[model samples]
Target: MTPSRARRLLPPLALGSVAAAALTGCGPDPGEPWAGAYVNVTAYPYFDFGAAAAGQSHTVLGFVVADPEEPCTPSWGGYYGLEEAETTLRMGEQIAALREAGGDVVVSFGGAARDEPATACADPEALLGAYRQVLDRYEVPVADFDVELNDLQDPAANQRRAEAVARLQEERPAGTPLEVWLTLPVSPAGLSEDGEDVVAQMLAAGVDLAGVNVMTMNYGESRPDGQSMVEASAEAARAAHGQVRELWAAAGQELSEEQAWRRIGLTPMIGVNDVPGEVVDPEAAAALNAFAREQGVGRISYWSLNRDRPCTAEHGDPSEANDFCSGLEQEAGEFTRVLGQGFGD
Candidate 1:
């Protein structure tokens, strides 16, 4: 995986250039609380810190480091940075503030819509180096790879990502491991083949993955009519756990169902999922929370915190997924409160 000398010459991301930071499960040290939600960095100030405080979602998974504008380069969705007009807040400063408030951040890379470094960076060593630079800048104990769709289907990129992360783990300081979670698309049947393969590849690459976070929402054309979203999510979690156990066992490290569950994370879209007619309401959130606790699941999060409130006006089709509200009838932070139940325990 050695890169050309020219590639090695590429400088690390300038710490000051990156914007806001994030958090989730910190590596195998196990004490890090896993309940949280994705918070977009640019949505800061508008993002309610009070809800996070109230819900006890001390860890936030921030989206995203889109893709390198160039090889081995890292940027926050290709727009946000320390530049004055890029964003009104500094990521480091905001992260510091969150830390001060007794919270933390874990930055997630890739998403359903963005180009990811694994898919874009050709040199494996350079890509690994780029990820290292991002971790160094953020100074967080966890990172998430939100691979989906095309990126999820690309085995080459998936293998490269696993190797890169394995290299990072090898370089970690003793007792200061970096937790890596692969967040992938899921359905009631559980992780798609590509999702299972990603986990297998990571294990094969010697990456001690901290967990697998399933995006258990928006089942879309795959979902049956009138199916409970909560039930769908639970089924998906169980299926994923089985897949992880089999993969780990095949990799010569058998994990009990409970062991696998502790490394599992559930993230349902808060209110209206992108799929028409699918909604994960407060009752569903409560059910998921109970399920998470009973199963000892490590993390529970929603699509976002910014959308924790009910839409108050006809800004758009309140029935669809939007930025400001959860598209459901409830007080602000209701979903947060229910889903984050037992958080910080």
Candidate 2:
């Protein structure tokens, strides 16, 4: 196993006793884990590279291409300012970013609309047919893709996606991971209500049975009335249909309320006011880090560095890239510590 990275000691702010209490007495125990962040290469590869280079551990990123031509072709997409033959150029660059930073990389597939038409995966069988090609391209045990029962909302489509995921899981050598992107709100009831009977449909289809990313930035509309940060996000996630049941099936034990979230997922994948009606909360961010540790969640990803922009609000002025960079740099260590690195820096 990789040695536990050193930890950080956060300087005290004018924290409330409650905040102090919140921060007190909890972190993952000896065997719990901490993972790094997912840098989205689509926005700015160089910047993404730089974030990994800073030594945060366990990076998961997507070099997604908005290339319409090879839409959903997995490894062979033909856009993103470079030609198709240059994929290794992309992967090689990402690999170097991690190796140089002492991190491991998981090549991601599917971004908002980057792989639309997903012509290659229109249905279950076609996707199974195309798996080997994607696997060979990324050369990683975990092949990442977004499969949401929320997206299609059609029961048949959800089932088709599930079967395809199951088939891929079966085909891959054991231990190879399959991660799905989930965009449900912080509560199952809200997700079920607004997401067109999400709970019933997904449970019936057996969708979301694999690992998940839980796409968690909410500018609002998608998030229902009172859910914003990841603690709420995680609570919402656990409340989903079949989640606890799925936990039972996967680990053969009932996940204590705390353990229902072991999937590699999203966290301060930061969002700011740029998300209309969205605001920032350092306290919530802290709670989120706390929540992940409490649940023994597997991995956490930030939806993007590009969206929140760090602006003067979170970091500094938009033009000064260092503002954005520094903010992440400052929080990264505390995040690492909260996520469960042994000692603090």
Candidate 3:
């Protein structure tokens, strides 16, 4: 399982700030190269997406899944409905604040913890409507679907999601089209057969995919025994880059090598990974950032902003993967600072 899935299955844990106000929307242009970290909206110790950290101001707030009681309805981590989240979680305010700070957010759907709307709502129209609601509410230009675990193998769910997203795009007003990205699990070898199929389904369904952001962590046995995390992740990204180009070519859309890399994103699980003995330390993060910048990788994001802090005494053991803190010795926001370098240039 991916880190996000594993972390969610564990017991809940507790878990930003402003920049040059004049530079609002000064980050990468829409559909262009960008970087940010994931924020578990309903997680504890509410994160401020509006604040700038490490020269980066963009964020991907997510895992919005179907409401447990009402599958067709959208909820924040299945804990609060859209309206309730606005009032209780201050989601709207936070997003507004982030945008005001000249940053933007990508609302992610379908996470490991709960059923994505498409998985729960079988009706294509209903699924489309569910996705539309969230997109309209957030008014975001980008949406990420983090498909993993069993969801990756569910062909029916995958097809439904692809179709729904395609229709959602068509229905959007011109000049305000939505860019959909699939955030999938990857290993050093790159996308699994299921992951590739998911991409093919999206392309076949006519969804103008923005890119494939590989979760470059928790490689388990995929990482060569002696290779460092950075090396392994770099390998995984390179492999995925090739696969993405081939996949697009097979779909009748040929892209150059540079173009393929531009359509690729790398998101590592910062600090300790769910897999034992695998840790992305601060140095590793900086190396990964350097590699990304050198390769012109489109996006660089970590598993979470919530886990970016060091494990404090109150947070308990630093050896285990905790929900709130990264099980590593580092300053707060260290990963973001290191990984965000050169992004949004």
Candidate 4:
């Protein structure tokens, strides 16, 4: 979708202001010995084979499925899952590639696009059971899920879900960790000098969280501020940690107890869709990765490994879906390989 001329005028006008802001699957890619290091390279509806090859490690690397329905389920994310046969099969092909790489891929349970709060909220056991059913279907012990108060507040209900997962982890086998992804928006609505607004809730929910992913790339339809998305995200994670877990650090940058919660993960977008020849300077990507490293946060996920860039940034069109990422998707090719190099395996 194209942006109206009026909205186009807003960015330059507010340049000084600014703002910001999962899991599982598969085997590691073949090329390197990157094992056990967290990597999240994804596709909207499919994971590109080429992209996976570059991002995989012997350790940990996975995909956070986009859950976009009432209570969007990440494993169910993308337009392809519901298809009768053909499309679903195509999606499975991507899944197969992820598995072959020795990476653990997971479909994220929630995101900003999700609206339906946890219907199982009132009954803790029921929610856990329901989520478990998800595990049964995917054939994985746990799925990466996010917890924001909009759906899981009310301390009574909150504790139930938390207890369930914490129990699940303690009881489950050694390798399983219910990783989750949450956003720390530059939009002030979710972020703060301290990111406590949502952290308390997540911690209250459970223990043994494989990790947390804070999306610091700040391009949203609402486009709040034009500040440093990287900085805002790092701060939020630091503030989010409570008694249950400790903030490791930002994705590449390190932080202090006073600054922000150490994010468990970072998602750097490779221009969403790259400009034909722009090849978005690697320095920008490296700086973000480096920042996360400083924070002690070691994982990184790219927005996607699928989709083709059908347009160009020169279009001046304000983009309907947070245009910043409009150009990143493409057929498996050179761009995918280039984007995968940041892992430093």
lDDT of each: 0.70, 0.43, 0.79, 0.38
> Which residue segments of model 3 deviate by more than 4 Å?
1-30, 52-55
Best by lDDT: 3
* TM-score winner: 3
lDDT of 3 at 194: 98
lDDT of 3 by residue, 33-77 (tens): 777898877666555655633235568887788888988898888
lDDT for model 4 comes to 0.38
RMSD of each: 9.8, 9.2, 7.3, 10.9
Distance from true position, residue 150, model 1, in Å?
A: 1.0
Q: What does candidate 2's lDDT look like per residue over 1-345, in tens digits?
A: 000011100111222222223222122211123354555444322344545334654455554432454433444233443344346336566566566666555555444433422333465555544554555555554445543323334455445544665565555566555543433333323244433343334334444343444555542565556766554465555554245435344433443333334433444444343345444345555666555544445555554433333234644453322313323323443434443232111
How high a TM-score does candidate 4 get? 0.57
Model 1 / residue 114 / CA error / Å: 1.0
Q: What's the CA error at residue 120 for candidate 3, in Å? A: 1.0
TM-score, one value per model: 0.85, 0.63, 0.89, 0.57
Better of 3 and 4 by TM-score: 3
| Clashes per model (N, Cα, C within 3 A) | 6, 9, 7, 66
lDDT of 2: 0.43
The order of the candidates by lDDT, greatest first, is 3, 1, 2, 4
| Cα lDDT of model 4 by residue, 1-345, tens digit | 111112111001100111111111121111111112222222222334434453354222232222334223423423323232235435445545655655445544444332222433345555565556555545553344443334334445445545656665565666554444443333323343333334445555545344445544443433335534444444544444331133322112233332232235555444532212222224455565555444434345554333214334653442333322234344333333343343443
- In model 1, what is the error at residue 35, expressed in angstroms? 0.3
